[model samples]
Target: MKQSTLSEVKSAVTPRATLLVIGVVALQLLFVVSYVGALHEPKLRDVAFGVVAPQASVEQTMQRLDELPGSPLDPRALPDEETARRQIGNRDIDGALVVRPDGTTDTLLVASGGGRTLSLALDSLTGDVLEAQGRTARMVDVAPASPRDFNGLSSFYLVVGLCVGAYLCASILAISAGARPANPARAATRLGTMVLVALAGGLGGAVIVGPVLGALPGSVWALWGMGALLIFAVGAATLAFQGLFGVIGIGLAILLIVIAGNPSAGGAFPAPMLPPFWEAIGPALPPGAGTWAARSISYFHGNAMASSLLVLSAWAVAGVVITMLAAVLRQRRAADAGSSAAEAGATEPPA
Candidate 1:
């Protein structure tokens, strides 16, 4: 057998190759840390809430909430019940207290869909407050999750499925051919396949969420549309990454979706309830946008669905364009190489 060529040896031992391996190992380790750290405890602390009551009662309610044993509630006084309700609906606060004018009973308005733990926390605290004041508390779920939804986690599950499909499909596509497609035709073919996959995945998700699992309730058609777009967007983005950065694209996707997006997605805690950085990034990413849209469609009469859909579409379009462009460049390079090889052969001396 012929000995290995010098070029082959160099390629195998190069620093570039070693660095790539090291980077992958680092990312793999980070994935474990990120997932565990974000999900391990799942405890709530300092949840924002509002108190609405007469001038005299407001001070008493705020003091009671502040004195709760564990520092669970971060209570602020609002001017009126309308403002408090609006804040809860807009997700500015997780719950609110509307002290009755007669002072015999207080209404505890909570958004269970925002976070069940938070709601339960408020309920327990409100009960204690009522008991201390010799008053009763009536619970109201203002932004309630869908009847079919439990723990308000259905949206997270659905979005996660979409993300998994996207990255896995893109990884498969990259492995089948080169990380970057060999030609424009190949790129187009892969994209067509991705589209079909997206559609099927979308429908499957809707069925599972609506009928099989009963984890979500909404216009099935709307959910289907969201599922399709979200899957396609993430998949296309993965494809674009692979086309541009080769196999490292898989690692990049993991970093973006799993490491960064998950914790920031408000899956464990709602956006307003999260820390500043996570809160800011949450809505911009696919997971956050998808969850928000899902909840809105299911319970909010689709009030904010359009904007989220548009964001997903934008990501999809951008990914498609970049992938196609990369494929075109690859094809051009291949054509140039072929031309150069032919020219060299024509000019070669006789053997």
Candidate 2:
């Protein structure tokens, strides 16, 4: 009997266990590919830059910037120096070159907090232009980064932490109960739990990143809201996947959040610095949107907050709908099976 029981246990564990291991391997491989591919070469090209000068100098400056080799700078002429500064602060452009009225010296305004690559690119490109005109240039870092925000990467780490917590918590939720719950009520409870978890995660992350670590400087409440929404959206999506796909759902969550999301997130490189594929998809996905929004909130004047919130909301709603539907269908099937078995048993003769 003991041997038979052990054999049965092995039989039960073998298929799913093997599948789970394979899924893990696949996820690990994907993680390596995504991270390496996205970050292997970090260079800036076609970064939006502004040029400001008198009418006589404007044409020459624009031409020089446009003709810069490697096409690193996409410079457009601004009407005045004030406009250039405004645009840079609003994130409309990365940096600006201001030509003096006397045409002897020029000034370059750059936001170092945005990215060091872009700032350095602006400096190099502007230096070339000024040298050609026999004029010198000075750099002014208008939007300087905090000393603690190394590479402007703290926001990315904080957001990733929240995302990881979300999906892991979701996986735990599935394991504690059935992957596909029996009814909408249980699905609703799961959602409620997710919300609670989101609240804790958001507040904890905000406090840690702000007061404890001094990594990010932003309104605690604003960061808290963003963190909560980000976590809940990721968790809800993971739960929906588990509901629809069983144990494979955890693997799928990892594939989406870690493998696909991280590299395209524009954490290491801003949008313009990424490859075509990552640049195109970065703004549309959760991680990318979250990163952009986090940066905007912390640095910019909350310009892109609304759109980010909408993207997160869409994920949360879709996850809830799919989870509830899957649960309802699963319960109906179980009910039908129970009813049919009862009827057949009642009609059959005794064994």
Candidate whose TM-score is highest? 2
What TM-score would you give candidate 2 relative to the actual structure? 0.89
Ten contiguous residues minimizing lDDT sum, candidate 1: 36-45
Predicted candidate 1 versus true structure: per-residue lDDT over 111-218, tens digit per residue: 777666667767887888788778888999988877667778888888888888877987898768667787878877888888988899988998898888777767
Residue 93, model 1, lDDT:
76
Q: Which stretches of candidate 2 lie over 4 Å from their true place?
A: 1-13, 67-70, 128-136, 340-351
- Scored against the true structure, residue 195 in model 2 reaches a CA lDDT of 97
Error of 2 at 118 (Å): 3.1
**Native RMSD of candidate 1 (Å):** 4.5
**Backbone atom clashes (below 3 Å) for every candidate:** 0, 0
